[model samples]
Target: MDLLVVGGGPVGLVVALRAADAGLTVTVLEPRHGPVDKACGEGLMPAARERLAQVGAAPNGHDLASIVYTDGRHRVSAPLTRPGLGVRRTVLHAALLEAADRAGVQVRHTRMIGIEPGDPRDHARPARVRTSDGQERTAPFVVAADGLHSPTRRALGLERPARLPRRFGLRAHYAVAPWSDAVEVHWSRNAEAYVTPVADDLVGVALLCRPPGRWDPTWRSFPELAWRLAGSEQTSAVRGAGPLRQRVRSMVRGRVLLVGDAAGYVDALTGEGLTLGTAQAFAAVDAVLAGSPAQYARRAPALGRRSTLLTRGLLAVSGQPAIRRLIVPAAARVPAVYRGAVHQLAGGH
Candidate 1:
């Protein structure tokens, strides 16, 4: 394989498909056989939609719309203006995997055990990978899109930063018409629930907060905003997602690169995780095909900074009851500010 990618998640699949399209022989190694169960809000920003279209991997039957934000007391709505899609993670992954297969990229249902740095002079000798099933795969470059707690990243001696203050997330889907064409992000102190309309009849809801030591206590602490929606209808059971925390630093190391949550992830507040992953996938693939690690290295900081800013901003707002009280009212009364903020939340910024 010209490149060995560890993790068959969305970022990994996108990397494989893009590289293959660029005429590179790519192999994706994933521990899971089929679609990995993803706990995400499952909304794609305009930029993400554009990237998918560029790669010819856009969803066929997905719903497209903007997002709406409310606080139960006050509400603001904005038309997407640009293209955005609300497709389930599984559906999105299936499309990417199909595209990878069509592009002649090999998919291996095996786990990567370790990665050792190789000699820079010899492309083949620079990176060596070991698989859990005793299979060894070697390539000029290795990609660690394995995710937030990446084993490949650990094996490469990459440093993991201290976990962020708040560390947990809960997400699920419901079968109901969205209150508006735009995604609805309702805010409350200590938490925020994002409701993204994936289809006319289905909405994706996710909550993020501090994790409790025990399972029962964790679910108990999660704030329930979906149930408070003005005219919400019952459709699906509530699902839980994560103890996801923000990662510090860049996502690149020598010939090994990280994309999506593997590199660094922000809270679900901004709804930019999927967009960031898709963008990084393109940048990484382009860098690999062009034989320039520098290109890939340059792309992470700006995106990472933005993610951090958004996450912190949301945390700040959600943490202070007074701030939420003041801001929510101001946002509702100020249409321009409200629209811009909602646009940013939709990952337009």
Candidate 2:
């Protein structure tokens, strides 16, 4: 094979498809079968939509809109003229798998165990990968999209940069009429609740907070905000995701490369994780085809820097109670600043 891609998530699948389209023999190894489950905000930003189109996998038949931010009382809604499409993880995965198949990439459902990096024999013996099923495979170039906790990264001995003030995430879906077409992020002193309209009658809610496991008290703690969103039927079981932080570093080493959360992650506040991963997939394919791993290493950081910076800045502001109080009021006062922030968060900027 010309390339071996680890993790059959959207990012891995996109890389496989793009490489295959460019006439390289491609294979993808994933631990799970089709329709893999991922914990995410599931809001496809405008940048993600554009990259999907480039890969011939644009989200279709979905209601599209911008995003809205609120401090519980005052709200500012901005029209994301570029508009983002809302698709569940399963739906998006299925689309990418189909595209990958059509583009002639072979996908294997198997858990990866180890990799042989920098071995001269890696070119001839190829990189050896052991699967959970006791099967072994080899390919010259490997792209790891295995996610935040990646075995591939560990095997390569790459150190992940520290993210200050670790946080956790909780998420669930609701069956009810959407309050608006836009995604609503309601900010509080220590945490924020993100409400994204995924369809005409369904919305996804994700809550983020610092660790040591606070937030156990539900409605009692956030009475007003909870009361306002009461009565909506829960469509899916409530789930949690994270330990989110700023993971700043290069995503490539030797023939092994990282895309998506495996490379580096940003705070989920920006809701741009999936979008950034998809964009990196394209850049990874290009760098590999050009036979320049250094170029691949150089490219991933630039792609995620802006969004990561914005996320870090927001995290700092949200971390301080006094700053948040002053910032929210000032942001509410100047609607343009709020709107611009929303636009950038929606991946327009």
Candidate 3:
């Protein structure tokens, strides 16, 4: 294989499909297969939706034109000038997997446990991979799409922990049909809930907050959201993910490169995690085909800066009550600026 991609999540499958499209052989390694689930906002930015279409991986989901942020008292709603979609994580994964298969990218069920960098003395030599089956494989280039807690990153000394306070997320799907055409982000003093319509009769709710101190059945903090989801039966079990901030030392080292959340992550506050990862997959494959893997380090992050900034900014405000109080009101006051910000974050800038 010309490329060995670790972690067959969205980004990994993306790299495989894109690389194969570029006429390069590719193999993806991931232990778990099928419709894998995770805690995610589950809303794709407009740019991401288009890119997936270009690569033949667009999945079926509800259309989302706008984003509405409400603190119960104050609210800011901005329509996307570009196209965006609300799709379940499993559905998205299945689409990408189908695309990869169609493109002839090999899918392996084994896991990559370790990597041995190519020697500098032999420029043509490929890196060696140790698999879960205790077999070794070699490839000219390797991509670490393993995700936020990437073992490949730590094994290569690329971990860089951020100073920001840790936050976690929990997600579940409700059987109720969506009541709104746009994604609704309900903000409160203690937590923020993201409501994304993934299907005609299924909406996914992901809750973000500091870990709970004690179990409480009542969601008194977010009365409006609780009321809407009150008696709706849950279609999926609650899935959690966190310590949402991940930092990295660099994206490229020797024959290995980090893509998607494996490269770095801030928060899902901006709902662009998969979008930026899709962009990175494009950059990484192009760099590999150009025989200049180092270029990806400089290019991929540039494609994601706007989303990263917005994510960090939102996290900061969400952590501070005073600023949190201002978000909706400020956006409401300057609708033009808020719309421009939304467009910019959508990669339309």
Q: Pick the candidate with the highest lDDT.
A: 3
Residue-level lDDT of model 2, residues 171-191, one tens digit each, is 777776676677777777677
Q: Give stretches of model 1 more than 4 Å off.
A: 60-62, 119-124, 213-239, 341-349
lDDT of 1 by residue, 5-91 (tens): 999988888888888888889999998976666777787888788788777687743455656666667776667658788887777
lDDT of 2: 0.76
As for candidate 2, its clashing pairs are none
The residue pairs that clash in candidate 3, if any, are 46-83
Itemize residue pairs with steric clashes in candidate 1. 66-182, 67-182, 67-183, 68-182, 68-183, 118-126, 169-242
TM-score of 3: 0.95
Over 97-158, each residue of candidate 3 has an lDDT whose tens digit, in order, gives 98988888888899888898674346678888899988899988898899989989988998
Clashes of each: 7, 0, 1
Cα lDDT of candidate 1 equals 0.72
Q: What would you estimate as the lDDT of candidate 3? A: 0.84
